[model samples]
Target: MKLIHAINDLTATHKDLLGLSKQKTEALTNNKLDEFQALLLEEQKLIRQLEKQEKKRQEVVEAWNEEQEYSVDSLTITEILQRLDGEEQKMAEDAAITLTDTITELKRQEQLNKALLEESMKFVQLSMELVNPSIKSMNYGAASSDKLSGRSLFDSKA
Candidate 1:
């Protein structure tokens, strides 16, 4: 009863997370820094919410285990499914599958976003390098250093 509700809630939260991940991919692709920043904040909130929901789910499962007097130290979803029968079991199994699928999709989206960010960073670095070329180290000899020294002009003037 309560466990099923908790599972459903968690599944819903994960679905929300998956949706946000999709939005993040769009924002990343479009180069919308502001939208991306907002999505990040929203993601943090969802993560916090997810943590609380997970804790609640664990508590409910532990409570169920205690109620049933299951001797097992850890009660996983599969183990819980064994005790459950009929509609509740079916609902829990469905929720688990959906959650797993959503998580997989989220990971894929995150990978795409990561690649986009890396490419954007590379482009920015290239642009900066073009604008201001960095000086290469002159390790051939002291003559190379002397040629680069500003003191030479001062010395010539003096």
Candidate 2:
């Protein structure tokens, strides 16, 4: 019973995470840095909560195995599915599928968000380079300007 409950909680939390991931993508795409930062905090909280719930779910499985006089040392998903029966079994199966699908969606969204962020960072760096031209330049020349014409004034090995 507790295991089912934990699975349900995990499923719900994952659903929340999936939603947050979508929101994060939107925030990044729209260049809403404030919203994106806020979502990052929310993401951390959900991830921490999910970790706790996952631990609880594993403990519940161990407890159930003990209750049913089964060896808990080598507990696997197949073994757990066989232990569960009736509606509980169906619910657990559905939750597992939902968990997988939602996780996949989250990953896709995260990748897109990462691409957007990388592009934005590249743009920022480009702008900075343009504004501060010397940031990417190397002047390995003599102190006198008269000696500069034949030497390299830029960042190059030539």
Candidate 3:
């Protein structure tokens, strides 16, 4: 059960990371550099937290295994079984609760990131439109005028 919870927590963290990456990509595409930087910082913090949690979980599992190994030789088999069962049950319940909380937090962060990305994109698009009315329709083509003579290539062609 503890293993299940650890896997769930890791999965939730991965989902949050994916959402963050999506937001960052959108922000970059829309030219929201400031917001992107802020998101990146938040992502780094979350990653650190996830790493810490994973390490702690591993330690707990290792400790539990070591206790089980020692108990196997010192205690009757039935007594050891009961103890292990109790510990496993407790671990499962705790893991479930932790995983649920982690998932909820991740979802909240994802929503916030999505909103920020949308706002940034909207702001950039509006700003661009306001700054250059024809920006959306402007096309890049070969220059009609010669750089040195300032003469229209079209005129020479004609």
Candidate 4:
């Protein structure tokens, strides 16, 4: 029963993570640095809370195993579910599946966000290149100064 609740909580937290991922994509797309930073902080807090919940679930499972005189090592959720019966078993299975699906979706959203950030960075780099073209160094005759100067692509190509 407690494991069921823990899985439910895990699913909820990851759903929140998915939402944050989407919001992060929006922030990056719209160039909202302040909102992006704030969302990242909130994302960190939620991740910490999710970790604590996982630990709490682990403690509960260990306590259950100890009371049953079972070895705690190598225990899977299926083993825990086997200990349950009737509606409790169904609830546990549903919660487990939901949690797994939610985590998968969260990962997909995270990947999408990462790609967006990468593309945004590439766009910024290209923009900078257009604004301040890189200098191609070339030595002049001995009478000329040693320093080489930059030229915009348009100017040099023309």
Task: Point to the candidate with the largest TM-score.
Answer: 1
RMSD of each: 3.3, 6.2, 9.7, 5.8
lDDT by candidate, in order shown: 0.86, 0.83, 0.67, 0.85
Q: Would you estimate the TM-scores of all the predictions?
A: 0.84, 0.80, 0.43, 0.81
| Candidate number that wins on lDDT, 2 or 4 | 4
Superior candidate under lDDT, 3 versus 4: 4
What's the residue-level lDDT of 66 in candidate 2? Answer: 83
Off by over 4 Å in 3: 67-158
- In model 1, the Cα lDDT at residue 131 comes to 84
Candidates in descending TM-score order: 1, 4, 2, 3
> After superposing candidate 1, which stretches have Cα over 4 Å from the reference?
137-158
Sort the predicted structures by lDDT, highest score first: 1, 4, 2, 3
lDDT of 4 at 55: 95
Q: Write the per-residue lDDT of candidate 3 for residues 1-158, one digit (tens) a residue.
A: 45546656776776777678777767766778898899899899879978987786676566665765753323332343355556665666555566667677667767766787687779989999888878336543444223536655466652
- Cα lDDT tens digits, model 2, 1-158, are 78768878988998898899889888887889899899999999999999999999988888888889976696876678887899988877787777778778778878888888899999999999888888237554355556765655684684
Model 4 per-residue lDDT tens digits across residues 6-125: 889889999999899889989988999899999999999999999999998888788878887887685798998888899998999999999999999888888888898899889999
Off by more than 4 A, model 2: 135-144, 147-158
Q: Flag the better candidate by TM-score, 1 or 3.
A: 1
For model 1, the run of ten residues with the poorest summed lDDT = 149-158
- Higher TM-score: candidate 2 or 3? 2
Q: What residue pairs are clashing in model 1?
A: none
For every model shown, the clashing-pair count is: 0, 0, 0, 0
